[model samples]
Target: MRRFKGFVRGVDGLTRDRGGNFAVLFGAVASVLALGVGFAVNISQLYNARSSLQSVVDAAVTSTARDLTLGVIKEADAKASVQAFLDANSAAGILQANQIVLDKLTINRTAKTVQADVHADIGLYFPLFSVGDMQRVTTSTTALYSDKKIEVAMMLDITGSMAPNWRSKTDKIGDLKAAASQTVEDLLKQNRDPGDPRIRVAIVPYAEAVNTGGLADTVFVEAEGGPKVPPPIDTPLSVSVTTATDKCATERKDKDGYADYSSDGPYTLRQDNKGKTYQAKVNRDYRMKVCPTAALVPLTADMSRLLTAIDHFQAAGVTAGGIAVQWGYYMLSPSWRSAIADACLGAGPTNFDQKKVAKIAILMTDGQFNTAFARSRGASRSQDQGQVSRSNAEAICENMKRDGIEVFTIGFDLNDPSMTTTERDQAKSVLKDCSTDDSSSLKHYYEAANGAELSDAFGAITRNIENLTINR
Candidate 1:
């Protein structure tokens, strides 16, 4: 009996030992599984938060780059703008104020590059499982802003056709004026620089001709008969040869005692030698006077007189777009160098600065060179035709460009010659070929059929000018 009881006690002890071992093994396995699951959850949360933060950073950098390109905001503002963008786009509760950091924002003006370094803290999901509170994510981006200056010119067509609907308030001229005024205002607003004149505008108004009413007389000479000559001398030879008998009689004593000499008709001269033969001849007629040459007025920012002059434009005679373009070129020519210098260094308070940058001319035309002023008998021959020839116009453009003056040509409401069936194709060809060397300088060239489209085209050009930026 004693031996049986001892064996039972031993069996009970063994069962207790097995039960304790099983409990210990199960606890260890369960703890390991919990830890693995916690690790996975924390990693996933961190990855997701990091992804969200990266997205915000990318967006901020992109926005800042665009603003910098447009010259709307400076480097300091760019950094601030980026930070603001990140704050607006970041996921809620993830990026705390302390987590967001702008390490560096360097704008290299000479290199035209904007570099930014961003750092953000990613908070851990399970604090008890992690040693540190957060992880750091760094990112950077560089953007370039072009510093090239843009030169532009605006040439308007103000021919006789422009006044077709003169009786109506919505005439073509009126529409053009409105479009031009709006364009000017927009351009001035968009690209305004008090420090540097990054862009300049010159308006050329042409109809049958450009009225150069203010140019120096020396630069333009009127034709006396066949060739242009200098101003006539006011000497005794230039005085009329007709006799003033009544005035001379009061100052002289005559043998016939007559107060005034009376001739039956106009005075005639007769000569006789030894009664052989005598002949009478009439006096020569006076010479015809020539019209003075037209003058050119310099361009200015003053809109009152310019707009008023445009409003009062009267189109008479034919269209000579080429001559008009040439005239536009002349306005910017150094041939007026003396006048330009005088104007710049003159005594007036508003004298132009000689060191100011050169000028530009925008020449626009809707028609081809069809007609010009007719040359009268014995008059100096003008360019065989009144309108400048295509070749001539091209040469003019080249010359102007050589003189540091840029030219932009536009063909409005004209058909392309390349399109065989379209009318006015020849005119289109002329305009298409009439542009400055740089194609982009010709901002907006459209073939509009109506006034609305024309106005839109003008607006488009103006907007382009406004949006142009010089980062330097």
Candidate 2:
């Protein structure tokens, strides 16, 4: 400031000089410099205002495009959505939006092209070449809000907590059934071509464990492509039902503990056991009481199968969210297609990371995850069953994300006011860590206080997954 004052004083002295011709030249030079500086400052404000406004428009258009694709809004409401978004974001930039005209908002239902044109009269800080204090800035954006092929794995929690009435209004399980069924209908409807459904959904209803049911055939050579559950075990039988050393085939911990924790089966599933004991053959120390009773469905595009799986889901047993997530990845992974060919309907993909294919996992849990076991006795396996389960859930989610699977997590009514702080913190931590990333505080992780919130969360997950498209 002192330097600037000194500069001003020098210029004033020059203007006051007795020599008339020299004083005139210096005054003219000072005038030009001041005008240039003022122009630069004003121009910078204009640039900044335009840039901020452009961001607001871009975000508004993207949200509108997504809503349209999700069928929540039509072409008519899209323009309205634009106006609402602008109004909502009025304070976001330097200029206040006085008027907005949706000059061209086109949604080609047949061609699936969404183009939007927005013209806004924004109050400018400094006038540009256009002679007004307000600038009419027009911005446009285009996006193809449709997916080529989407494979989603939904892991629904059927643990004991989900069996009861929800808060007061709903039967929790009924709400889950309704939410999941509607999500299926919504996703399938995204295919503009009715005959060409590029969407496939898998359901993993988890309780004490995920009941792979028929898909276990892909895991055990002994079941000979058959079911692995009881004729009811009267006592711990000495005989091995499946060729699995541990008598557990469809469940990953077949020959070795390592294979149990992994989605990829590496052990000799059919080989005869040389060990004398079941534990020795299976290479596992303990046995889970029984897998969940609710049926498990692999990835399938058939809407009927998807809905049926949701209907068959009954609330029972404990929570093994980690196990359910591990199986969810298997449903989406291309490598498992060969083994799960029958369940996957003989269809297969080239690779998991294919550009056009989107692999996603939607995990919803009603209570704290309490039944997870390490594939091997590693650092993750804890004496505290709840801790181990939560740990395993996060670890499996990490692996799935690393393999390019987008993960969305939901904790439905997990916060019981009576619970201890540690118990409350555990569920939130697991859900947050299980999501794709934390860039969006509201996107990947959801906390639903009741059934309505739960349904809303599911709706959001469905739309976000549906929006993953290469067509754009």
Candidate 3:
């Protein structure tokens, strides 16, 4: 019996030792599993934080890219914008701790690209054997700014037909004004250059006839005594011939037969019944002196005058897109080359960067070409018509293109069935053919069927200009 008890004691001792060994093994396994779980949690948190930081960087880079292209924001501003984005999107605690670092921010002006690199150090929950730094995360992004300077002219239709809501819409003039003003603002905002005039814009409003705004003076003299005088004043002259004569007393016409005599010969003087001896002013000399030059003045930041002109736009007469386009070309022509050089050479090319400046025309119309002021009876009429003919438009576009002038065209809400398909086709063909070779330049053409769409089209063009980047 004693021997049996001793064996049982030995077996109990073995069982206790085995139980202790199992306990140690179980504890070690549990510790490893716990460590694994902690690592997984910390790694996931690090990934989440890294992703969040990368998103911030991406947003920042994109914002900077847009500003870079627009030319409005300088490099400093772009960097600031990126920083602001990061600060705005970062977690409050992380940002305060300065755990996020913008390692690199580069803007390649020549390449028209922006690049950003970011790094962050994240804290890990598992301190087990602390591996170097708790966590390190990095991200980068690149964006391209591939737009170019835009030289554009806005040719707007202001014919009497526009007086009626031809498209069965609301006030046509109001809509036009809004669209035009917005477009102008957009262009100015997008293509701003403090040091150079990268883009030149002009507004040409036309009807059966365009009011040259008293261009007769400029034209008649420039005509070099050609039969065609500057186009007749669109509206009557504000100052009548009598008023003009009254302004000059030396040569006023006289009612009395004996005009005021002078050594220069009986001065062409006149006496009124009121006994006011009015002299027929030989104001012709003075008129000649003040006669307006046959030149179109390029506009600068003359926003007030431009806006006023747009507001006063009256829909009178008929549509003459051909003449308008011709005028647009003439406005930028070197016809006054000598004068431009003389007046602006001293000032360095009249607000334009003569070195890299480009000329452009934006011709838009909703109607077919039907009239020209210079039409003659026989071949001249045909010739004048031909100048505005679709073929002629194409030729003009080609010529302008050859001269390195970019051209953009737009056709708005044209739904006239009476208008032959050929006419519409002609307009489209000319517009498409007139586009510039540059991708950004060529993207300016648009066709819209409604007011909203028209506005959007204009906005899109503006955005394109804003995104322009100088390659060099």
Candidate of highest TM-score: 2
lDDT of 3 at 317: 52
Candidate RMSDs in order:
17.6, 10.5, 14.7
- lDDT, candidates in the order shown: 0.50, 0.67, 0.55
Predicted structure 3, TM vs. truth: 0.61
Task: TM-score for candidate 2, please give it.
Answer: 0.63
The TM-score values for the models, in the order shown, are 0.56, 0.63, 0.61
The 10-residue segment with the lowest total lDDT in model 1: 245-254
Candidate 1 lDDT over 1-472, as tens digits, reads 9999999999999998799789999999999998788778778877766666666666677667656654567677877887787666655445665466778878887776667787777766655444676667777777655444443345577655555553544356666767666665554443445444343344556654444443322222222242121112222444412321111000000111111111111112222232222112111111211111222334444445445555555445445555455556544544444544454521111112222343446666666655433322333445454333444455556666666554555665554232244337656656666754534443534566556877787776554443333211
Q: How many backbone clashes does candidate 3 have?
A: 19
lDDT of 2 by residue, 1-472 (tens): 9999999999989877757997788999998897677678767766776676677777877788777655557677877887788778855667565454567777777666677777667665555465667666777777665434778889898876677654654478887998899988887766554455577788878777666666554433233333222212232445433443322222344433332444553222232233322221112123465555666777766788889878876777777766777778777777666666655454643276536678889998877777654444555433576776676777778888888888999888877665577877887889889998855323799988887888899898876776555342
Q: Can you write out model 3's per-residue Cα lDDT over 341-378, one digit (the tens) per residue?
A: 44442121222332244565777676666553332122
Q: Model 3 off-target regions past 4 Å?
A: 1-54, 65-79, 91-99, 106-115, 123-133, 141-151, 166-170, 189-200, 208-297, 330-360, 372-388, 402-405, 437-442, 470-472
Better candidate by TM-score, 2 or 3 = 2
* Highest-lDDT candidate: 2
Q: Which stretches of candidate 2 lie over 4 Å from their true place?
A: 1-140, 144-147, 165-170, 219-251, 254-261, 265-286, 343-350, 373-377, 380-382, 440-442, 470-472
| Residue 326 lDDT in candidate 3 | 54
